[model samples]
Target: MRFTRRKSTLWRTFESRYYVMTLLTPLGLLGLIGILVLIIIYIIRPNFQQKVVSSTYVWKLSLKYRKKRLPTSKLRDLLLIICQILVLASCAFIIAKPACIVKSTETNSETVIIIDSSASMLMSSNGKTRFERAVEAAGTKAGEVLDGGGEVTVITAGPKAEYLCEKETKENKESVLREIKGLWNDNQNDIKCTYGSDDIDGAMTLCADTVADNPKANVFIYTDATYVNGSVPEGVNVIDVKGEEESNAAIINATVTQDQNNYVFSADVIRYGTENTPLSLKASFYGVNDKSGENGKLTFELKDIPVVANETYRITFRKDVEYTDEDKLRGYKLVEESKLVLCKLVADTDVTTDEEYGVYSFEQVMFDIAESDAFDFDNHYFIYGGKKEKLKVLYVTTPIDKNGKGEENPFVPAALSIAKNYFSSRLDIEVDTVMSDKQYLLTGYNMYIFEGLKPDSMPVDGVTFLINPPKGDYKEYGFDLGLEITSKGSEGDTLSSNSSNKLLDGLKAEDITVSKATSLKNFTGSDDSPYNYESLLELNGSTVAIARNCKENQTVVMSFSTHYSNIAYGHIAVLMTNIIDYYFPATVSGTKLEVGGKIEINARGASVIARESGFTQEEFTLTEFPATLVLTRPGQYVISQTTYFGQDLTDTIYVSIPQSESALTEERYSLENPFTERDDSDYFNDLLVYLAAALVALLFVEWWLHSRESM
Candidate 1:
């Protein structure tokens, strides 16, 4: 063997034998100091006794010694000394602590498995879904890894990539297998795959991070995905779990629109992996507000609809439509949509098509493919088109004159009339006026406006506006009004406004002048209270207009009268419009969203509850206005909440799957591994016992040679 002073060496005992020797403890080589001591001992000469009659006696003794000693005897004596030196060297080498370095093999390694859990994985073949097959494959791979004294990690690539098991060894093999099997829904049919798109990049990133410390770790991805050209990395292995080609026809999208006096239903159907297959669509509508027994829940089917593979075919269902030649070419069909029947029958009964009857129309419609395809989940879809609730406003004012003609503020009424048109497209607004002394109810209104008067208590559900509140103690509403302060001159006092406040968005504070303004004090201080206050308009550093908002209700108090302002004619309308817009915002900006789409939700009640039929249910507390909601699955979601007034408010929205996930035969994306390969796989084995054996053999040989010389 060749020994080196550095990290390792080569040890060879025979012509074909080979071993890579590594020094585990190089400090042990200090034992070689014994070689120097042995040399010093051999070099020193022993003292001899002095004699007088030596020459003749010495000559005779030397002659006798020479006659008895053969030439080979000296060679034996030299060999004995060499054997002793070799024995000493063997002890030094044993103390050096050498070992053999060998490369690691598959018996011990680290492995990571990534499973695709997207909607496309729900595709079934022979009653077994692709997700199930992927789980089985992952479990097999994990079992093999654990049996070989290796560690295994399993991660699922769903809407969000997460770990199923991390760094599991043979000791916990049973628990790891149980977790892998839990992915399949054996007992219940709850969805096993995510309805949203797969996070392939995120899964790969997690895998890369996991194997960062182990360069020789094995990574396997079990999915039906086919990578692009040269996309798969060198060390990773992707097992495609897809079987034979399967044909699928799906109703990808559906919508409902209002025509002149009827409703029109439209749907887009698409086929995958099949050419020119005859398809049919069936639709069922459930009437929610049809008081007239004329329109029951109806179902209709259109057969032999022509659709091309991978091409969207749009179908329309309407009543009393003359089919033009162009319409025939565009694939328009004449079917009695159920919503049209409900609306037409109700109109025949001579009922007004206002808020009372609008809600009684179709709430939800179920559309399905007549012939079942390989993938059943995409075969059906739902459309929710419920009517929105109207916003009701109650305005109560005191008369300045004895006549009832001055029953309400003319400026405030005019401003509300203008707001009715501005918010016409978003909400249906209704205004009711009443005298403060006359009988009026404080419940069941979205907004309460009081002028020159204060109610006993504010409504619990909706917002409230107090314009020029009369001097009184209003601790019931959590505030008190003090004596009024009039301006010294006819020019009046200039108002100071908060520019950052959204209530004063368009109104200019410098131009406004108030002849008299009341002092406001002693309101609740905590932000959680319903009377949480922020000054919007201030006169001489005292608040004249303030805005309060909390979870229970929202309020706006304007202490100054509009009649005293120099520009009250035009400015009052603008100020009133801003208050209406800020207090009563739309609940949902959009009613239709696709998977992975986000929409803003303005809570009108204590919280917002979003629920889909049998799939998803989530609740978000109404901490602030305009919270964000993300649509992770496709279904008919009903967004509802309970106001503090014990009224249940609801709105329906539709979420649909993206068009990209419909093509099961096509590969969506590819992944690449970023990890590096290990260059060195060497280990060490101790050789101290072998060196000790060699020392014993050397000592025995040295004794035999010494005995021969003595004889």
Candidate 2:
């Protein structure tokens, strides 16, 4: 079988001997002039001049003595001349670098080389990164293909796969090499491997055209990635440039949860390769808004934690002080709390382990084996989800009766308070509660909650929440309510809620009982409807609870009073929280994302400015809601924007390297051979070395012959 492998063109050409022998540097043939000089010397070589010898008898004796050996002598003389001529020719050929041209099936075959420039390629060994090695190998392969009179294409698999060069031939091999080498900066500090995880599939797709154009084209990929028990595309070759062995420690993930008076900080730490690796974990909290008499910064550490390879160890930290289960569930009640949490694996030299406020727990012991931990990018993690801004809320309820009693449902106010405490880290909530008889203005509040009362005009300035809205014609709110319907039995009617509704995210409305409800009218699902509404709660095929949104305002109407439903028992708080989340979503949807990950930006302002830790500020205009923001690098980004209501809000997003990239010894599949149908033939071998050896042997033989003749 003639497997079309990339053999050196010169070697293959000479080995196959399909074509006649040739000289690489024909100018060296000038050495052949030595043969002409030798021949000329033989012609002018002084013919035996007839001279009167002093002794004819001696000459005659010598002639007779030589006659016996004349035949041998003549043969020797002829042999010597032939050897001299051959030696001169050998010298010429050696200088010319003689090579045989043998036909090889791969001569005209194209080669496509893909270089993986992912973040994991930044692994360094012997001062050279994997990307550097891959680039070098790619260049060498390209040169070989070009020298064989075949075209070469170079592609890079980074965040996106793209071609570095296409159809490069020997004529422009140098330029192609230059382009590949340009992936690294002069200092080698900045490389094209800034992107996480390679897009190998994309890169291979780029080779499709070349393969189509040349059916015999060979595709090769140089990367540090490995696939475990996985096979790559058929007919492609994968060259793994991984180091001998590598060990890495990564803080793969981190998050904070409110635990009563203290916060619980947890992180996933992993050691890629190395058994019983001893490492320290450090947790630092900045801008922590807590109820603890103290504030500012809090740090905790776990020292000499032996982490096993390939295992994820979850470490959790909380207040050193003790608390109850209730406190644990509620999280420490804090006057103020902002947790800009940072978790990192301490390097070998940093030995400080602080267990002051909280101790840490290592949940698992994972083990795998690798040699070096040179890639340090994934060691640190940041959690900035705890920081929040201010949100103003206004609550209006019915006035007091003659007995100094109010007709208000206390459940609404209670749910609001619960939501305020639950989202304390993300929002500083200020609530103003007033009786319906008092003068209440809704223009300044971020949210307005009204219960058991109807205003002359609907509030259009903020998110409107009408609890047990009374029957009325509310043209300003775009929808009106029908007469209140009373249930016939005390058991009340079980309502079914739209589980898909964002406002009912965690509530089970089917279990709730409502004895009375008002039906909503004119909420048809139509483009021409005055309000863009979504039914949240339904009873007997009628929408009892509704949510609507527009550019000018947002409204949520619950037709049933809290007193008439089982919702006040416990579901009210959860429903309120979901409502707040849906309307006032965070500026950035997620707290953490992988490098090259895209995040949704739902800015309340006209524009948003994102500033990453080590990058320039990026500004995006909010032409619409939920804009896409692509994070290309690993860092903490602060997104800031001012809402239309003049409320300045800021959020933090952490971009990290893909966890897969830290697995230094991940199993990878090799590229399959796409040229199965191609002729498999041995390439021509180079004849330069053999010719030099022959030349040396000829020289030695000529010297021996000359020495014998002299004797």
Number of backbone-clashing residue pairs for each candidate, in the order shown = 1, 38
Each prediction's whole-model lDDT (CA): 0.74, 0.72
My TM-score estimates for the predictions, one after another, are: 0.67, 0.61
- Give one digit per residue, the lDDT tens place, for model 2 in 348-408: 1224764344312221111112224668677787776654566889898875454547565
How far off is residue 237 in model 2, in Å?
5.2
By summed lDDT, which 10 consecutive residues of candidate 1 come out lowest? 338-347
Supply candidate 2's per-residue lDDT for 356.
Answer: 40
